[model samples]
Each structure stands twice: as C-alpha cells, then as structure tokens.
Target: MSDAPREIEALIEMMAKLPGLGPRSARRAVLHLIKKRGLLMNPLAEAMQAVAQTARECLNCGNISTGDVCPICTSEKRANGELCVVEDVADLWAMERSNVFKGRYHVLGGTLSALDAVGPDELRIPKLIDRVTSEGITEVILALNATIDGQTTAHYIADQLDGRVNVTSLAQGVPIGGELDYLDDGTITAALRARKSL
Candidate 1:
C-alpha cells in the first residue's frame, strides 16, 4: 500500500474483506489480476457484472437463481415429496455439491439466535412452512450445522411441522460447532444418508 497506486491499494483492501482472503493474499491477487487485465481481469469483471445483474433469490425455495424460482425448485423431477432444510444458502450449495440429494431445498437464511434476537420471522421459516403444505412435501430433512444455534433452529422448525410431515435431521457425524460450508462433499453425503428422525 505504501508504494502501490491508490486504485490498486483500494482493490487490495476490498479483496481483503472477502471471506477467506487476507491482506497478503489480496495484494498478490490484485497484482495477478492487474497483470492479466486483458485476459483475466476484464473477463472476470464482465462476468461479475453479469452475475450481479442476473443473480436473484429464488422466491419459492430461497436459493439464488437467475429467475423467480431456482432450477431445482422449478424442476418437476425435484418435487419428490422431499425437502432439505438448510441454515444458509452456502449450506444448500454444499449439499448440492454432494450430488446425492435429489430433492429441493428451503434456505432459512440463518439459524435461530436468541442472543442476536433472530427468530422465525427474521428468516424464511414461515415461507418454508407454506412450501411444505403447498408443495406436498412429505419428508423434511434438516441439513443444518451442528452448532447450538443450528440445533435450536432445527428443533424449532421440527416443532412447527410436527405430525404434519416427517421431520428428520442429519446424523450426528457433523463436527461440533462446524458449518456445513466448511465440510467436504463426502461427509455431507454420508450425513444425508444417515439422517435420523427428529
């Protein structure tokens, strides 16, 4: 930052704010992107612009999509009487990467948090309830993390849908206090396969 131009230094600062990036990596990445501006940086910028314009949250399932409904929520093949409830969109993405679950998802946006004053209304919990009934969802598989807040959210949702539909949760293999986005695909698949009733 001491020697770099203001624009480049600003870019590094912004990149450093991204989730997995730090000051050291952000500087290196900015340098790389600047060096390959014609081939990489320009195209990357265009792609980011395109996605920013097109990306949207699916109205039905809460997944990010280019349209009102995500491909999974709109696909007839995915309406298999099953719904996977995830704590975050990132968790939903991780489950998709597993390539094992064929059903659709309901992203709660985040877990229930009393400390932060987050509740069902704060997230998409009400929307999830509506989807279960309207979409004929028979089984809801909870893929939330193993964190305290995650479990609390899971139990809250389970109680909301009690006896109306079969509610289950990912088996106890998920690491304590771990986030789904941090897990490998195989662990996710195994958890899905070993899910137990709530």
Candidate 2:
C-alpha cells in the first residue's frame, strides 16, 4: 500500500544494527536521507564507499590509514620521542580530541584477556617495543581504559618497557572501568595532565 520499497527497508534494517540506532531511529533517518538524497545521501554514500575501500591499519603504529604507514607514524614533526598507547583506535581519537599530547599513538586494537585467550602477542605489544627502540621514544603513556583488562594490559606494557623508557598511566579519577571514548574532552585532558608513573 505504501510507496517505500523493500530495498529501502533493508537498508534501514542494516543501519539499525549500528551501535546507537534502533529500528525507530533508523527508519526516521532513512526517510530523512531519502528526502534529501540529492544534498546529503549521495555525498554520504560516496564518502562511506571511499573509506570502506581505502581504510587499512598502519603497519607501524596500528592506526587506520589508506597508506602503508599512518600520517602520524610518518610525520617527522610528530616524532617528539613520546608514544601514547591506547587500547582502541576510538580511544586514540578521543585523546587526539583533547589535543593535550603532542606525540604519535600506538593502537593496541584490544586489551589482553586471559579469559578470552588474548595475549601480548595478539596485541601490538611487540610492535610497541620495537617503536620504543627505533623511534627513540622517551616516554610511553598508557591511556588505556580503567577496566580490569585495561589495567592489566597497562601493567604488562609497563613491565615490557621497564627501565627502557618512562612509563606512565592516566591518573586517578578515570572512574573505575571507564572508557576514554565516553569521557568529556576536558576530563581526558585533565587525566592526561595528571598522569603518574607506573
């Protein structure tokens, strides 16, 4: 009875599976996009297609990039002898939003989990150590989440880099098991500024 097609409904269903969207919101979004197809939807679809085709992880620091090495990893200016380690790319982006740290980042992809059989090798730990040596890193900051897994990963990294470079972790008030992505930018800056050594 309706003009809307089944293909359009399928797109909405797929969009609803995304993190925050539900069926109601997805339906509304799809309708809105269809209404503004010429102005918004076409460009959005092209951009998504481009990213989907080109996105790849940086071989060095594990940051997402279209190129072999991410911009940060290749930038001479960003080679400030400081390395910020994060559990996820989202966490790295949150730290970048704060603009507090002037160094490159090493994304771990995920934390070490004994329960899930995740180990140091599964993460970018070995690569991080290599960067410390080759990049002449003076400080290694752990901006991991405050969860048990995050802390455990932090300690493991600290131990790995012990006596090699200054190892520090984001200070108190991170909220137990709080994620960097969920924190306000100001809170992230404060936590980074007040970070203490391991």
Candidate 3:
C-alpha cells in the first residue's frame, strides 16, 4: 500500500491510467504537482476541467471540437475539392502539423477490425460517403496507417466510392532518412515496389 493519503493515492492512480504513464511515473508526476500546486496544479486542473466540459465531436467530420463543427470544417478556405480521410483525430492533427494538405479532413475514428467486430457502421464511413457527394469533393485521399486493418478499411472505402469520386492513398515506403539495411523485409519490399526512376 502507498504511504500517501487517500486523495493523493487516488490522484496517482488516475494519472497512471494515462497513455505512456506507469504507476511509478504517475507517482513522480503527482509529487511534482504537489510541489508546484499553486503554479502548475491549479492551472492544469482548470484546463482539464474546461476541456472536459466543452469537448465534443464535430458533426461534419468527427473531429474533436467545442462546438457543433470544428474550425477546419467551418473555414471556407478549406473547402477545396480534395478531402483527406484519416483514422483518428491524432492523424488529422498530424496532417495539419505538416501544413501540406490544404483541403478539409474526415476522421473515421478507427479502422475496420473483424476480430473486434468493428464495421463500416461503427466508423464514420457513411458520413464520409455523404460528405463526398454533398461537399463536391473531387478527390478522396486515404491517409490511413499501413497496418492490416488500416489497409482493409482503405479498400472498403475505395470500393464504396469507386465511381463516385477519384480515390488516392498516402504512399507507404521508407522514411526520409532511414537506412535500407535497418529496414525490415516489408519496408524493403514496399520501397522497391514504389521505386521511382531518376
């Protein structure tokens, strides 16, 4: 049992549930918060509370938002003919960080998983199809991860929108600075298949 009080122990346990945080790390974080209660803990708590109260899914694209629509969905400048489809909000945020894709986004929330019984209805796939027609999207870019389930989901989406719109996918191969010797068999195969002529 921990020597800390019940409240502090509870806090540590709660923090331990966060991604990438173990019990020991949570304990250290809790202790740090206690040490900087006035300067850090109060603001952190306030911010968490604000987010908890205001956070909601965007009605249009399934992105997280405080209002019915996310800023990206509402912005007129993002209304290009291209629509990028991602597996989650984190993927959408990553794309935004790159600043390469100027068009709007559609978050599918997760990939299809037959083992887990997740299907098209479980994701935002239907909404994606509706948006393709309603928003006058000319191109649908599948930005899913290069996993089995991600590939399955991408294929399903492509088949669904086969004749309706042009479909494309993010290229999968080697990283920018990655060494060929360090890459695995799959990476080498994919890179060889996607090889470009100089």
Better of 1 and 3 by TM-score: 3
lDDT of 2 at 163: 98
lDDT of 2 by residue, 45-163 (tens): 99999999999999998888899899888889999998999998898889989888889999998999999999999999999999899999999999999788998999999998999
Model 3 regions more than 4 Å off? none
Residue 24, candidate 1: Cα error in Å is: 2.1
Stretch of 10 with least lDDT, candidate 1: 169-178
Question: What are the Cα lDDT values of the candidates?
Answer: 0.92, 0.91, 0.97
Give the Å error, residue 183, model 1. Answer: 14
Off by over 4 Å in 2: 1-4, 174-198
Question: RMSD, each candidate, Å?
Answer: 6.0, 5.9, 0.9
Tens-place lDDT digits, model 3, residues 116-161: 9999999999999999999999999999999999999999999999
Give residue 161's error in model 2 in angstroms. 1.6
Candidate 1, clashing residue pairs? none
Candidate 1 has an lDDT of 0.92
Put down candidate 1 lDDT per residue, 1-198, tens digits, no spaces: 378988889999999999999999999999999999999999999999999999999998889999998999889999999999998889998999989999999999998898999988999999999999999999999999977899899999999999999999977657778799999887788778878899
